[model samples]
Target chain A: MATATVILLDGLAYGMVLFIISVGLTVTMGLMRVVNLAHGGFAMAGGYLAAMMIRAGVPFFAAAALATLAAGILGGIAEMTVFRPLYRKGELAQVLMTFGLTFVFIAALTWLFGTDVKILPIPSYLAGPVDLGFRTYPTYRLFLIVVGLLLFLLVWFVIEGSLYGARLRAAVDNPRMARAVGIDVNRLFTITFVIGCALAGFGGVIGAEMLQLDPFYALRYLVLFLVVVAVGGLGSFKGSFVAAITLGVVETAGKFLFTDIAAFLLFALVFVLLLWRPNGLLPPKSVA
Target chain B: MNPAWHALPWLLAIAFYFTAGGYLSLGTSILVYILLTLSLDLALGYAGIITLGHAAFFGFGAYGAALFAIHVNADPLLGLVVATAVTAVFAVVTGMLILHTQGVTLLMLTLAIAVLLAEAANRAYKVTGGDDGLQFTMGPVLGLFRFDLWGQTAYLYTLVILFVWFVIAWKVVHSPFGRSLDGIRQSQARMRAIGTPVWWRLIAIYAISAAMAGSAGALSAQTTRFVGLNTLGLLVSGIAVVMLVLGGTRRLYGAFLGAAVYVVVQDFAAKVNPFYWMFVIGGLLMATVLFLEGGLMEVLDIGRRWLRRLLRGSDPT
Candidate 1:
């Protein structure tokens, strides 16, 4: 029972971090049809920025927020210069270009802040365990779970409820039609891209405690983020949330049960799941 | 094809034999990449399958050859054959599962398969030697030439294999089967409408490409007498793609050209500043996508055309 509880708590926290990091990729891939392999580069940048700020004595929360904003701004710049030109290219071109961008980011980060791994300093208040009614749990993990749920709700409300959400959906479904209806699709793409990148940065800073912050961080966890997006079905917010949590739990359980073949077991699970649903667990309603 | 073009690879090989006396190993490495990129061209350029996990086959072949040489016979030819067979089987099994999905899903599946294999190799250190990799000396080529320290025999052996594979690839790309692949690439639905077995064709091409990549991997292991985890790494797969795109896709000879250019440039840059070589590669890749549409082949073709025109004008013919 104790093992199960610990696994559940740890899995939830891990899943929440995965969701926060991968959600941005899902949105961009769905809307832009661009395989932005460099999405993790933004996360890496945010992580380093947050780590540096925290080391400089700023509060963790404030540093994270500032780092996210910085990431958003950097995303805006990249979208205008690099990504805008690639919107019309084929998937192959997009893959190559974004891949190159990832290399550049990795090299630049290595040059800026040596190759050593940098850990995010968690505040003392959020470090220790908190007493739950049934059991005691780490405060930081509980905080992560709560934050993840809150972000999910906020994102869900904004994407599924608001008028802006409708416009974004319209633009994603048919950019020409959306433009014909005066929806300003180009502007919509810009805003959506920024938001997606910002989310990645925010996730990077917060999830750094679990995922680790380093120069190779971008490429190391790229496949995991991609797995979440692929299994969740590109462009589906709820799908990503569910997939992330499921993967996290499965990964945690696999590690506990089978130490050596945990990665193999996780991949096998994903493979079986993918075989069953080639399009993903929950495909979008309107196919592109 | 022009006679000059037919003799190009051989002429280049001979030229390198004399000029690459010091960098013979680098030359051999380039030949290996040519084989790998050629296999990629078969899949991505002709079959239009967007795969990022090709290194899986390469790594499998390398490990298979290394294990075979260590446990069974040390003959290079036998090792290559065994490696190719192993990778072909692996490709067929995985291709059936992955080729069903197209676009991003296919890419994800391919990457997943490779990563799984890499992780498995990493964990099964008892067999694979973990991250440290497996090392084993290979017997002489054709049971006549002995393995040497200067890599002279290895270079010649690799050159012969590369030439043979080039002929096979060239023949495959020009045959009716190759034309069918082009049709499938242009429009899978159209190919299916025309009663072509699109899935079987893809499976066949993928297996064939895997075999070729496996041969390259086997050759690497035989020559270097070492097989590391990086053999199956994502970076290897990505570099293959970059090399293929750098030369030009769909054109068989582009593989050689791209591999040559990429290897030479990388070697030079690494020697100059290993730390920033990635930046150079990244810049080149981005520039290729943004500016060079048809790759280095197209530029060379333009230059050749211009030179011919200039010669004709001067000759008054």
Candidate 2:
């Protein structure tokens, strides 16, 4: 029971990080209809930026905030310069271009910050174990869980409750029709893209401790983020959240229980899940 | 297609032996890439199946052949056969499961399968030697030529295999089955309307392509006498795609042209600065997608047309 509890907490923390990172991708993929394989590049940029700031004796929180903003600006520039031109092109072009962009980012990062893994200097307060009534848990993990929940609620409120989200939804549903209705889809896309990138950057800053900041971080964890987005059903925020947590727990538990065949079991589980639901776990209602 | 095009690969192969005999290993590496990219063309170019994890089959074949040689027999030909068979089975099973999906979902599925295999290989270090990879000596080629350090025999052996497989691919693509695949690529709905067994055809071609890729992997393992986990890496899959795209897809010769250009450029750039060759590759990919629509083949075709018009004294349009 004790082991299970520990596993559950660790899995939740891991899943929360995944959710924070992947939710941005899910939104952008849905809104833009572009694969954006370079999404992880933005996260890497944020992580690296935060690492640099913290090394310069800045507080972690302030550094993270600045990194998020910088990542968003970079994302905006990319969307305008690189991605905008390819929106009219096919998905293949988008994929190829983004993939190339990923390489460029990876190479650039490697040149700047050598290949060694960069660990974020966690604050002393967050480094120690905190005593819960029944069990002692790492403070940083608890912090991650809290942040993930707050971000989830914030995203849910923005997407489901706000007027801006309504417009975003309208644009997603029918870009042509939304434009005809004077929704300014291009502006809407730009806004959503920036927000998505900012969220990814924020996730990177927070999850840096957990996921490790490295030059290869973008490519290494790309598949996990993609899996969450794909399995969650594109454009569905709730679906992404649920899928991320579920995959996180399952993967963590599988690794813990089956040391030898953990990967095999995880993939088999994904295959089964995908086979059972080809469209994804929670496909949009309009499709049916 | 021009008759000269059919003779291009052969001419190039012969030219390399006489002119660049010192770089036989590089030549052999290019040939392996050609086979791999050609297999990719069979799926992506012909069948219009966008896969990002083709290295799964390639790595499987490499490991299978290496393990077979270490445990059972070292005969390169028989190992190639066994490797091809193993990958064919893997492809059939995976293809059946993954072919039902389309677009990004299919791409993710393929990537996942490859990653899964790579992780499995990493964990099964007892058999695979883990990250260090499996190193084993290969026996003589067809009981005739011995594997050498200069890679002369390896080059010729790879060239022959590549030539043979190229012919098979050429025949397959030109056949009615091949035309149906083109039809599917163009419009799956139209093919289905016309009574084509689209799913079955995709599965069949995927398996065939997997077998071809397996042979390429087996060839690499045999020639290099080393098989590493990177064989199944995303980088390999990505490079194969880049090569296919650069050479131009659908055209069989494009695989050769693309592999040659990419490998040669990579060799040169890596020699210059091993750490930053990715910049060159990435820049090239961007230029290809943005400026060159149909890749180098199309550019060459355009140049040929211009030359013909100039020779005829006709005003170029």
Using lDDT as the measure, the top candidate is 1
lDDT of 1 at A243: 92
- Model 2 regions more than 4 Å off: A286-288, B314-317
Query: Candidate 2, B151: how far from true, in Å?
Result: 1.0
Candidate 1 ranges beyond 4 A from true positions:
A133-135
Docking quality band of candidate 1, CAPRI definitions: medium
The per-prediction i-RMS, to one decimal, reads 1.1, 1.5
User: What fraction of the reference interface contacts is present in each model, in order?
Assistant: 0.63, 0.54
lDDT by residue (B1-317, candidate 2, tens digit) is 67876787798797897788688898999999999999999999899898899999899999999999999999999999999999999999999888978877788788889888998899889999999999999999999889988898899899999988999998999999999999998889999999999999999999999999999999999999999999999988988989999889888878988999999888898888775878788888888888986888888889889887787886554
lDDT of 1 at B111: 88
Candidate 1: tens digits of C-alpha lDDT, residues B46-152: 99999999999899999999999999999999989999999999999999888877888888888889889999999989899998999888888888999899999
DockQ of each: 0.72, 0.64
Candidate with top DockQ is 1
